[model samples]
Target: MHALREVGVEVPEHTLTAVTGPSGSGKSTFLQCAAGLDRPTAGVVRLGGRVISGMKERGLSRLRRTHIGFVFQSFNLLPALTVQQNVLLPLRLDGRPRDPARARELLARVGLEGREGARPGRLSGGQQQRVAIARALITEPDVVFADEPTGSLDQETGAGIMDLLREAVDRQGATVVLVTHDPSVTARADRVLRLAHGRLVQDSWAGTGTVAAGGVPRDAAAVAGGGPVR
Candidate 1:
C-alpha cells in the first residue's frame, strides 16, 4: 500500500491491503473514496484499471453492482429474509432472476449449507458474517472491500472470517482491501497499510518480490516504520 500524492493520498491497486488508523485518521475516508462510496477533497482512486472518482452515478452504480463487492462490520442482512434470501439480495437488486441453487451453493461454500432457511436474526454472529461474505461474492467482483468486517466478533470467529476472506482472495484471484485497526486481522493480509492523521503512515508488504513502502508490489508483506510516502 502506497499513497500517491498528486494532491492528497491515494492507494494504488492490485494487492491485499489492511488499513489501520486512529479515529478520524481517514481510514474510512480512504476506503469510501477508493471504492467510490464517497468522493475525496483531492486525489484519484483506480481499481481494476478504471478510475473511480470521475465516473457518473449510473456508470459507478453499474460498476459497483457488476464489479465491486463490499462487506461491512454489520452483516446488513434483511432480518425477514432467510440466509439464502439475504445472500441473493444483490442479485435480486440488479433485476436479475433468483437462482436458488446458486444461493445454496454459496452458503455451503461459506459453511452455512444447512442454515439457508434461517433468518438473519436467528443466526449466530459468525454465521451472519459468513452470509455477508457470500453476499459480497455473489457478483464475482474483482475486488472485495471489507470495512471493519470482524469488529463485532470474538477472536476465534474473527479468525474464521479472515480465513474465508483469505481463501477467497488466494483461491479465486480476487483482490481484497480489508480495513481494520486489529493487528491480528492485519497479520493475515498479504500486505498491510497503516494510516494516521489523515495520511498513510506505513505500507507493509510481505510476499515474494515485495517492495518497499513507496512501491506497490504485488504479493506484498507488512513492514513497520514511517508511513508510505505521501
Candidate 2:
C-alpha cells in the first residue's frame, strides 16, 4: 500500500499549516516527502521554484542545509557541541561565514541569552527545545518542517514553543509545516490538513472558516491570496 495517495497541498508563505491525523495515518510520510527526505513512488514535490523529487541526494543535502530548517521531537542536539555551536551548524555546513551576532540575537530571542556556552545535557527539556528552535531559525530558512516539536514538553512549555513558531511566520515570513497530534496546535495553525489511509481527508482554514474535502484546488492562484503554488 502507498504511504500517501493523491494528496495535494499548497501552503502559502508566512503561514503555519498543521498536519494532524491518527497514528499510522501517514502524517510523517507526508512531511518527509514534502521536505525532500523521502522519495514518493509517484507524484512531484516542489518547493519554491525547484522540483525536489527530481533532485539527487547531493543536491537535496545542499538545499536542506541552505534553504530548509527542521525541528524534531527528540531535540536532536549533538551532545558534544555547545548550544551556540548546534545553532550555527547549518551555516557552517553551507560554508557561510559565521555570524556570531546573529546567533546571539536568535539565542536571546528564544530566551537563551546567556546559556550559549552550555551543552544540551545541562539544560531542561524546555530549554533544550528552545535551543533547537533557535537553531531552526538561525539560518532564516524559507521553509521549516517540524515533526511533533512540542510533543516532549509540558503544556505551558509547549505553548511557549508554539508562540515562537507563530512569531517566525508573523515576523520572519517563514512558512511552517508542522505535524502534531495536539489539538491546541491544530487550533492555533492558520490551516490544518488531516490525513487518513494515506489520503487527504479534510482541509480546514482558520482564517476563512472554510473546510474542504480532498483539497485539490482547481485554481491554486486563488488559494491564500496569490502565494506560490506548491
Candidate 3:
C-alpha cells in the first residue's frame, strides 16, 4: 500500500496549516512529499504555482533555496557558521546578493539581535531555535515547512517559538505548513489536517470551527473543539 493514499489538501496563501497524527501515521511522509524532499509515488506537488514533485534534484534544490524555507525540530544550524552567516546561507546558495541588513533585521526579529557573531553551539536550545527561525525567514520564502519545530524545547520555549511563527504569518504574510503531534500546537492552527494509516481522516478549520472526518461533517466539538482531531 502507498504511504499516503488518496490524500489531497489545498492550503491558501498566508495561512498556518498544522498536520497532526499519531506515530507511523504518515505525517512525516506527507510533509516530505509536500515540501519536495520526497517524491510522491503517484501525484503532483505544487509550490508557488509550479509543479515540484517531478523536478530533478538540481531544479528542486534551486526552487527550495529561492522559494521555500524550513524549520526543523533539531535546530539544524551549521556549527561552523556564525549566526548571521547561518541566516544568510539560503541567499548565498541562491546566488542572490548578500543582504546583511535583511539578515540583521530577521535576527533582531527572532530575538538574536546582538548574538549574530556567536556560533550555534554557544547558544541554548531555545536560542538555537530562534536562530533557525531567523534563517528560515531571511529569504522571505513563499512557504515555510516546519517539522515539529517545538518538539525539542520545553513548554515555555516552545510557546515562544510558536509565537514567532504566528507572527511570521500575521506580519510577514508567510504561508506555513507545520507537522506536529502536540494538541496545544494544533489548537493554535488556522487549519488542522489529521492522517491515519496513510489516509487523511480529518480536516478541521478554525475559521469555520468545523471538522470533516471520513467524508462526514461534524461539529468541531466532536474533536475537543479543535484541540485535536484524535
Tens-digit lDDT string for candidate 2 (1-230) = 66787777777788999999898888888888888988877677889967998899999999998889888767799999999999998899899998889989888876789999999999998788878888888898999999887887788877877888898899989999999999999989988888888777788787555456644443232222211112
How many steric overlaps are in each model, in order?
Answer: 9, 0, 0
Decide which is better by TM-score, 1 or 2.
Answer: 2
Candidates 1 and 2 compared: the better one by lDDT is 2
Model 1 residue 107 CA deviation in Å: 2.7
Clashing pairs in 2: none
Best by TM-score: 2
lDDT value, candidate 2, whole model: 0.83
At residue 157, what lDDT does model 2 achieve? Answer: 70
**lDDT, candidate 3, 115-206, per-residue tens:** 98999999998788878878888888889998888776778767877887898788989899999988889888988999898878888887
Worst 10 residues of 1 by lDDT: 220-229
Tens-digit per-residue lDDT, 1-230, candidate 1: 23323223333444567888787676776676767887644555666667877888988888888878998777788899989888888888788888888888778876788998899988888789888988998877888898888886788767877877787777877778978988899878766666666655566666544333455555332222322323
